[model samples]
Target: MNFGERLRFLRNELDYSLRKMADELDISFSALGKYERNEHQPDFETLKKIADYFDVSIDWLLGRTQEGYDHAIRIIDNAVEKMDPNSEVELYIPPAILNEMILKNIDESHLSLIPVYGAANGMLNLSESNIIQYEFKHNQDMPEESFFYIISPDDSMKGSNIVKDSKVLCRSLDIVDKKNLEEGKIYLVSYQNSLYIRRVFVNNQDQITLQAENVHFPPILIHNMSDINIIGQVQSVEFNPNEQK
Candidate 1:
């Protein structure tokens, strides 16, 4: 069923009148009618409000999945109930494992996979490492080929919410031109064969300044930009550590 059909079904299931639903949602009756008729699509905020009111996941409202919020809650509850508090908990499970559990019966052609690199104690040569693949839903605007994952080496960027040992999703700068570099943005950089994550500052001269979020680590200045290798831009991070057993 489409979004409109689903919306109408939800309202009917709740036994709410059109006027009552509209008034409760703080939207015009005509707008609600338009949504039900599929004549006009509600904005993201409106859709979120509707999801909240119906106590359903947005995925269900958008017809992405038949399973509602209750199903999701049950899944969480089941997982929690199976956990042993005294045992070491596996915090970060790669998406591939989830796919094996949930998408094993689904067609493999529709699934998209991205490389996730495990952490290395020293400088990592991406070409030499064996990467674990994880299912990823890519944004249309993202350059998928340039995307890769790395683990944060230290807590230097903790002030910026990037904690140590966290997995970071990055986009390689090989695909991005030097002129497109934005100041005050975090990037995965290579200098003197060592990897570092720092906020970038480009000056009028040929120099580039790399600043650590932690004040304890002083700002690093590279006299020539050529000396600094732009590995990639840090996009997002996931922190999940195994607690003591």
Candidate 2:
């Protein structure tokens, strides 16, 4: 069941009227009705209150698990306890929880995209599981255009702070114009039918040089501007996994 249906079911099971429940929760009856109707979702704090009042887990309220609330909490607690404080692995949180948290905090306007990942010459493909929903409000002065999100496929750009698995917000360029290209700025470009996020530098001979932030990866030289397809400029990088919580 969805969150609204579950909420209503719990309320019905408790034999509480909408008005009474609203009064207890310190919210308006209309707001509670909106939540039940799925017209509006509760913020994290409100969700916590509902979960506590209903004696349920956040996962259960969000419909991520069918396990009883107490059991789910025990499982979550054990899993969290096993995590190392300095580990690089991302901690797992159910997608529903993350999605709701993001929706509640960001501007309603946003775009959802499957992040493409691969090297410059390798076959680029969209990740089936790494879909990201991002709101484009970081650079308000920039002109609006078609935007997409991509994940940095490797540590090639690690030196520039664009690490692996980082979500990059890009503005679509579609066409490549060497004259308009700025040197030392990172861009999402297509070369040899593969997508890449790399810093572009213009040479004196009009050649375009693609450089990796990491010195280990050698710079690629492109003599023909037509050989490179400019996908877009990288606008921002979102690296924090905790923000989704």
Candidate 3:
């Protein structure tokens, strides 16, 4: 692909809109459009910025080499394949870094699958599931067995940049964990047999306030704490790379 075609492909690979990609590159929307259409070309600095932002080499962006962004990913994969898992010196890669690789369109076959589910009621015990498929087997402190995935259903938490359909990592909460809930933390909760994602505020032992990041959703005050079923504490939220910009 040519520069423009590659730029468009990388943007579309992550589902970035022209305006969003332009804003990220600090360029005007019209200029980005023109570049994509081959009507105009970005300056040297802008060209470099585009290449950096898309994680591709300038040579590749300019069509001088076929080596794509996945070139490094390939090297890492090959090294990992040859490395000994039982080596005395262990190699640990953080989940954030691994997630970045996943965001770069790493094959899912390399991912360590976790059960993904959707939030339903306070119990959230739906029979169906499609969990997060991140690279690492676990998220360090949070083991693989301790957490699962749930799809963020709406814009209620958009203020936190967690858009709808984002994969939410929820650590399973036990009674002890629920009692030790942290203030101002978002959680998956069940009340009135429905699920909710809201920032939690400790009121008293028997009461609490659930606040929505979006102003349109009014805060809910639960007088009886027992009625509020704390399902799990939200660890991390990941926007699907394929999500529409």
> Which candidate number would show the highest TM-score if scored against the true structure?
1
Ranking by TM-score: 1, 3, 2
* Candidate 3: clashing pairs of residues: 115-131, 116-130, 116-131, 122-190
Per-residue lDDT of 98 in model 3:
53
Collision count of model 3 = 4
Kindly report which residue stretches of model 1 are placed more than 4 angstroms away from their true locations once superposed: 1-111, 122-125, 130-135, 138-143, 175-178, 204-206, 240-245
Better of 1 and 2 by TM-score: 1
Residues 103-166, model 3: lDDT tens digits = 3445433444345665443234434332222224333354555777777777677777666677
lDDT string, candidate 2, 80-116, tens digits: 4554445433434444433333322222223232233
Candidate 3, residue 121: CA error in Å? 12
Candidate 2, superposed: residue stretches over 4 Å from native? 1-123, 126-145, 240-245
Q: What is the C-alpha lDDT of each candidate?
A: 0.68, 0.67, 0.67
lDDT of 1 by residue, 80-142 (tens): 444445534333334443323232223323333455665566444465243533334334455
Better of 1 and 3 by lDDT: 1
